[model samples]
Target: MNLFENAIKLRGFLAEDAKVPPSDGITEDAFSVLFLALMSGTWDIATNEWAPRTTVHRVVCPGPWFCGFTRGMKRGDYVEVEGELYIHDYDRPVVVEGERSTAKRYVSEIRAIQVRKLDRPLLVIDTGEDG
Candidate 1:
């Protein structure tokens, strides 16, 4: 028996509106792509301070169902995503030491299974007084 899984769940703000390829007379076959930015922090033992980090992930949502579902999403909107991890490889032109060359680039993205828009929590001010 063999067991293997590749899954990811992320909650973050949308970096920008969902992008889709221009219609080629077939709108129902387009794929919706989303850029999600997640923030995190870690305590540095040596520096004794907090280190902040932000990771941007590309999420691909396929089919007309996902496209319509994500149509209302925009930049700065908080959302949750569940998906499988996938790595895509492509060739890109790069200049190396003043020489133009085509290089293979690999990008890791999530193939979204589900997506949900989440309401952000409001900040509350606390005063040290009994009501």
Candidate 2:
């Protein structure tokens, strides 16, 4: 299942178990990451809509993988994805070399959704039904 669906299932299980660890465990971190990933589902696919000016990254395999930049990449500069730090062959995903505004905004938006709203659980994986 996708991150959201899995989060929902995991959340259900966690709620039933009184033995769940205090919220400071590594598992909690993992859960938080999962939550963010699920929250990013829409943006990941439609990133062009979010940052149309930015270059689109084409992964060799199917992916909506989260990429962290060591430095703000500029056009023609090389970038590394996953953990291949030594390989600088991957083209950076920005039209302007040092423009991190769009990328930062995308991430910040996802974070905003998570932190600003606390009324309901955000644990359902997107099935392309809700946009």
Instruction: Give a tens-digit lDDT track for model 2, residues 6-70.
Output: 11111111111111222344231222211211112234455554422332322221111121111
RMSD of 2: 19.4
What do the candidate models score in CA lDDT, each in turn?
0.88, 0.24
Estimated TM-score per prediction? 0.78, 0.13
Model 2 TM-score, all chains together: 0.13
Count: clashes, candidate 1: 0
Off by over 4 Å in 1: 20-26, 95-101, 123-131
- Superposition error at 73 for model 2 (Å): 1.9
Q: What is the lDDT of residue 75 in candidate 1?
A: 94
Q: For this target, which candidate reaches the highest lDDT against the unseen true structure?
A: 1
Local error of candidate 2 at residue 111 (angstroms): 14
Provide the clashing-pair count of each candidate structure: 0, 3
TM-score (C-alpha) between model 1 and the true structure: 0.78
Q: Write the per-residue lDDT of candidate 1 for residues 4-123, one digit (tens) a residue.
A: 888799999999998865555326567899999999999999999889999899999988778778877899999999999999899999998999999999989999999999998676
lDDT for 11 in candidate 1 is 97
